[model samples]
Target: MTALRFPALAGLLLVALVGISRPQPVAADTPAPAGFAAFVDDYYAALFAWEPNQATYAGIHDFDEKLADLNAPNITHRADVLKKLHERLKTLRAGKLTADEAIDAETLDHAIRAELLELEVVRDWKRNPVVYLGKPAEGIDMLMKRSFAPPADRLKAVIGRLKAAPQLLGAMKTNVENPPKEFTDLGLIVAKGSVSFFRNDLPAWAKDAAGKDKKLFAEFEAANKPVIEAFEAAAKWIETELLPKSKGKYAIGPDAFVKKLETEEMLDVPLDKLLAIGEANLKRDQETFVATAKKIDPKRTPAEVLATLNEDHPKPEDLVGATRGTIERTRKFLVDKKIVTVPSEVRPTIAETPAFMRTGGFASMDTPGAYETKATEAFYYVTPPETEWEARRKVEHMRQFNKTGMDIITIHEAFPGHYLQFLYAKQYPTKVRKLYTCGTNVEGWAHYAEQMIVEEGYGDGDPKVRLAQLNEALLRDCRYIVGIKLHTEGWTVEQGKKFFVEQGYIEPETAFQEARRGSYNPTYLYYTLGKLQIYKLRDDYKKAKGADFRLQTFHDEFVRQGGLPIKLIRKIMLPGDTGPTL
Candidate 1:
């Protein structure tokens, strides 16, 4: 059998005339070699069905009314389904497919392996108590934040998820045991934080919601009240039961970490080698930071110079407006420097970070899914200090969003950073590339943009601005080093924090948070890892293209390849060149 062409009727007729109907038309619907496209389509269908909330966020509304079935049986069922897909993928001949299809094949295969590792190996759902809190919080949040659907329609989806919330969380009492103390504490924080999302944000959003049937409101009240109550109970359980029994161990170990790096990022480098690379970068940046500080003010140390920059921050009332001010200046810098083709002139809308999101970071960019053609508004969110925080604490927090820091933040989150990357993501040539993003690719581009902008003279030789950019880079570089040592070298949380303060030039308070983040997120190193890979890629890309390699063209081409591992990007961009990813 050569192939089954589309127009099902015609293919069926042709198959019948050939006298081979034993396997049934459905199985024979696609022939072996030419069926790659159909095979991919089936994979996407299974993906969306298995991860419906993901689909909803991706703007594939077909699964908008569904939530993932977290019950053990359902998880096993999906895992089995993916296992079969992985086996089937092996039968396809890479030489027979188009280049794009071949790359998609690799992306889908990598994604399958990563998910299986999470389920069968890493298994956060079973070990991490915070899994229970974070999932539902994110699920409800997406429905609330996006206007992709009206409140009434989105409400149904939210209610469906809420109805399932009790059992899913309840199952955790058995499923999660001996989680790390950090996990339990964070679970408590996220759980406590969720109450506000339900009590305040949900009600406020639904207050003027259209099509508010009394019956629907009753349904929502019934679902919301209990789930909110259960959320509190879950937090109490983490504190009471889980905390006493909570272990201090959170490392996934060298074997699992290496597998994750190879599977998720396609990097084969060992942990020791990765740490060495991180240290080298850290040393270089630290030297430059000090040298730059001397230029800013000869009498002050680098930390003192950074503090002075922080002191020049915006007041509480001007936070959002101050962030909005950075947009045009950064964009104009990019254009004038010919750093990259921006692909868009429209700036992302400035917004205060949502209440639920403020717990994590000072600022970030939230863009619609690549496939989302409507309601395409992207937001650059600045997390303002909580109103109830002490005036001194508020002042302390505002220092992070200082005018220079805000400029670098906007460059990282907007300008030629995440927002710009997503704009290209929407235009990526393949569906798999559009949907399955590698963290290194996504974050690395943004992180790389920060340093690249500085090198291109966005700050006009201002030592303070250069110091701010290096500060961000040093933070990532520390994460890169600490992540390996904390997980693979039997280092404690205290050790990680000390490393940050010593190497990252961060304060004790912020260092603790960064170190704790490394405890749960061993892969936070991606910011530095990805940046290094892009830098390497640019060097080789520049070498390959010779005089033809325009910086703007190189950047445009890089994002166009979508969020694949730098190794995969190498094959695409530098074609036929088999090389290490830095």
Candidate 2:
């Protein structure tokens, strides 16, 4: 069947897509006008100053000593600046710019408008308490994560941020009113984890980093005291003041949800149509899951077959070693099959998930920002089952990292997934493309890799491997349906959880977490949504190239475009194709 293509829905994307011309060769003496390029540079300069923590993460250390001034007036002023930038961007003619620069302009324009939506319309700063608690904690962690600078230098920046936490939390207390109960719960979790980070984990690191600098150590102690107290107070206030009043609905409603898709992903499908697509995909993956399970064992039910796979996981003591082995094997397979270019020989450090990040999930890829240079180490964090949990609870957690599933997880998190994509960051053409990423282009690519590799014979046509791949796909399919239903159809969390268990074949415990995450993270359906878009793009590109096409060539071109919306990338790769991206 021919895949469906979505039209550009929002006025902004239409403006962005206007005068879309092919790239023409320019003589060395006759360069394109610097108007667009100069504005991009100036815009990021202003952005770095306005949001200092963002700068730190981008490896710009000039702003490392400060946190963002998130006071209401400053936020208003920042939005005002972005509004003017958006206007200025619309004036630039795409005909006058280079092909790459025009796409960068579109990316930057979308990013600006999206920021405006958050600041003016959605307003998470005023609604979600997690924004306050999570941002500051993340700021410190970013500094600590890599040795971007000398220990003393990074500690100094950490102290500077610590001193500013009280004001940030004060803004949180003032701005946050009646967020959803799930958001409040998240805020409380962040607050408690933040307090623990400051009180326990931080001081131990500080002592080692501070060394013999008595004055610096004393200053660190002084700054850290108030930050700990502030988080403690924030947690208390959330429980007593916020949770009781957290009666706000998590739904952004149909209109805002549609608008979010347009602004963030340049997608314009209607909610009912989008939901229909998700539902159809869910049914498809569920049927595949049952058939694949039967191939593994015809006598057993699908759930019973999955249970046997779960028992194939490593014990707690062997978890890290087992994961490390899979990473090498996956990397080797990609190179051996010539699946895609592995630009670097460097491997990501496989480690236990840090204390602050272990609230949920099994494994993740934590790569440095594109602009980050000195501290370029990427981490593939796999959270082991906690020792304190009862044996049954531990068993349930370990099932997530079962050997067959871990192969899929490793591929998603490392080889030719996020870590592989990061290697091409320096090659991205523009600063705007480097800085701005849409979820569809990023997470979508990783999810797509899971199926692509399996289809290409990663597991050598093993039914167990095929079932594991389908298992992961079903989880993402469920996310697509549940995310839309929760926000647009007014489905309750329990309803969403039940859908995961029955349709996705997920365990009830993990199902509850995935459903709750949708309340706070409404657009997570991007995993499946993005994978489908890429598949559509690949199918179209293959027809265009026909005899000359190579799978490696297509994969290479996709990531080289950086993380623009797949729609914009479709325009870049297949310039004249006015088709839907499904």
Candidate 3:
């Protein structure tokens, strides 16, 4: 039997161990393939040993005794391993492998290539030492706070890693001895938020798991004090030394940005094409917004209507209650319309955004990771209104957080969206398909879901709700334009911010934040780009299926493909001689 090469799978598993064990036999009659299954099993074993915190997150406790080494030597060693694995995969013949084995091999190939690309093409970690230096070496802490593992197990992992916290800090210091100033500045900002993971959240978990593990709390407090000190030192270094020297520019220029776009997203189109798509979507969504605005108030123009919507928005009397009400209403709409079957496993909870994660956005969904067997749940985290703000500023912020906006966010971040899609993804059998999630498909589906549900008349004739939905879509469209323009078209931060305010209809402060974030996160474009790809794929699939193409059936099948790249979606949906072009 030919040796089925799966170095790619090994590479991905190495990053953060998902719940892939041995490759189960294809069926009873078809015996397990020889080399391929062995490759997968061996890869899983190595992964668990190397990254115990990762294993714990995946619900595998065999390696709960150790933690990942974020030290320089370990990072170098892993890079070397990835290089060897990529070479090994290149030597294997895919045609000789079994059908299932071939799929695994293909996935492995993609993963290895991606890792190699990251190492070769991306030099941010090395060039901007502050980026690495500023990061908290508390994967265990993160896993615990995220509730990826049981409280007891998470506590144990935290204690184990805490014992090595000094060494991790030493390694970080060594790595950042000559770090870039920009990295240090950003690192300081991120680090200031770090201690809260232990100071506030860890104690809550300890209280919850009190009777089960008495020693856990003591161990946590003992280990955390030193870790907090080290983080404080790192933060000081970033603020004092790094920020002063941060002469480095954030953008990587057109060529690097294009390569990053392709590498990160596996997108085929150039940056200009992406910008064009964004512009088109912005125009389309704006028209929809205008029409909806007219419905809300025929006398007012779209711009005037938008201003009125903002003017009549609510005060912050009971924020959580208001957001929860929106969620319940959205769930009812999904069920009533029969838009798609929501799995019983879909349960969404509203929570305050963790301080560490608030840098990313005002709200985000914490979907169940691939390895989770528990019912897929999501966290619709709303960042708490700023406490120190004066009454007027506070009220203005509250006005920004209206019921219409919350409903739009709920539809995008929860029901019939990320949580629902994730529940469907859990049903996919292939480890490669399940583990290697496509961000485009994931975010895109949620973005598309927001508009899709709104178009189906979800908000009980409330044009404010519909207007908010279009505004969100427009925000994503602005992201795409700003992302491409900042990186590929040499647009400055000021230009990007202006474009957001003008084209996206976003507030100046929000636009500024969005533009700044785009400099570092080029992948933000995935929201609109992914939606467009899915929409195109659906239209083509519908035409091909002819009379059989029910919307729910199409949505069910599309999501069942397990968040594969849209390029691969066409292959799965239309599997014949003439497949859709990339």
Candidate 4:
């Protein structure tokens, strides 16, 4: 579990939209070709039942009152289910399906295989304590953050999840044996954060609901204590016991890592070749950044220019407003330039970063699932500097939200990015497509959006804006290289931090934060890696379409495929082509 990773009101409509493409659950006995759609619906229903928190987040709230059963038996049961589903999927020949169903078949098959790998091989739950802690905190947070249901109804769900929370910790005590030191350390951070979440943030949120029903409130108050104490105890256990005996290793090693790339993302490139591609991309971005900085002010050094850009930020008071301010402008640009369809006319609701999630860098999008019913609000979260931070630390943190940086981040997180992507998720061709997504497709699209907008003239030729965009690219570029090195080459987080500072040009404090994030999230390289793939695909797509190539048309089609990997996207767009993704 992580310390970080939230509400709704005013909206009266409860959108009980289920199964993205189809209105009802797929029938079990339905035959193939046409039945492929039913298979997807069945797979999602089963998957969401196993992951109730995800179900809630996805806008299906039937399971909102239950947390996942993380004990060995339940875990094995779910894995066994996936195994059966895997075999069942194989029985239906993709060769027999229609064009669209064939893609869905391949995607659903890949998704099942990927989960089995994590369950059987990667097994982070058995090795990583953070998984145990993160899930509950995220689960409850989902309950509180959205206004899908009434406060009373949501609070009841919270109470139910809180009661179930203790079992999660007990399972952790049994399941997470010897974790990596980093895993233990990060687990403690999140566990402690969860403690704060329950004690302060949770009660404040529950008060209104409690106020409405004193008995229900008392019940919630009664139930909330054990969950808070459970998290606190888990944090203590991690600090005292797990940290001392953490003999667990973090690296998946070369073979497992390669298989992860191939099985999950359908990319079969060698690690060294992947690294070379990442490095080449980084070099180009760094050079462009330096050149852009020089253009901003020829007399100053590149680093000095970067510092100036960092300093050109919103005051702590203005961070959310600054982020909010970017939306209309970005949306207008996308529409005016025809960059992509605005799936819906709606704008994302901008809000402050949740307290627990504030430990990481500022900004994230909490999108309601396309099929989200009750809590339909999609939040664009921006973290402000902590009031307790020293002036220097505050300045460093705020630098990340500098004028141009805000523009670039806004591009990535909102307009023509995640929020936009979320808008289209439901309308995709298949149910499985709406549920399963790879980081390469998800983060890659966001990262690529940052660059694509600037290239499409969002920058208006301001070198500083271009520099800010490049700096963001450089950070992701560093993640690409650092993820590869830390996981494969035994580089320490400290070494990764130095690389971020020297090569990525990120400030030291933020640089360390990014590096530590890599320790836990190694596949983050998908941002830059995915961006590169999208670029290649776009070029190939343009070549194929020739005069038919409209940038907006390309983007509209790309996002419409849901968050499938670029390789799968290539099959749909550049039909029958199996060229390299990069």
Prediction-by-prediction clash tally: 0, 3, 2, 9
Which stretch of 10 consecutive residues in model 3 shows the poorest summed lDDT? 1-10
For residue 148, model 2's alpha carbon misses the true position, in angstroms, by 1.7
In order of appearance, the predictions have TM-scores of 0.91, 0.92, 0.85, 0.92
Give the better candidate number (3 or 4) by lDDT: 4
Question: Which digits, one per residue and each the tens of the lDDT, describe model 4 over residues 1-582?
Answer: 011121111111224443343223233354433356666666777776777776776667778778878899988888877776676778765337887777778877777877777788888889888777877778888888778778898899999999988998899999998778877877877788789899999999999866768899899889999988898888888888889999877877777777777777778799999999999989998888888888889999899988877888889998888888888888899989889999688787888876666556678887776456556677888888778879988888888988878878888888888888777765676555656677778778889999989998997988888888899899999998998888899988899999999998898988888888887676778888889899999999999989888988899899888778788899999988979898
Ranking of candidates on TM-score, top first: 4, 2, 1, 3
Please give the distance, in angstroms, between residue 324's alpha carbon in candidate 4 and its true position after superposition.
1.5
Superposition error at 226 for model 2 (Å) = 0.8
Q: Residue by residue across 205-272, what tens digits does model 3's lDDT show? A: 66675445667677777887887777778677667776676666666677767665565456767666
Candidates sorted by lDDT, best first: 2, 4, 1, 3
- Highest lDDT, which number? 2
Winner by TM-score between candidate 3 and candidate 1: 1
Clash-forming residue pairs, model 1: none
Measured with C-alpha atoms, the lDDT of residue 62 in candidate 3 is 53
Give candidate 4 regions above 4 Å deviation: 1-34, 387-391
For residues 164-188, could you state the per-residue lDDT of candidate 2 as single tens digits? 8899999999998899998898888
Worst 10 residues of 1 by lDDT: 7-16
Q: Tell me how far the alpha carbon of residue 38 in candidate 1 is from the true structure, in angstroms, after superposition.
A: 2.5
Residue 234 shift from truth in candidate 3, angstroms:
1.6
On lDDT, the stronger of 1 and 2 is 2
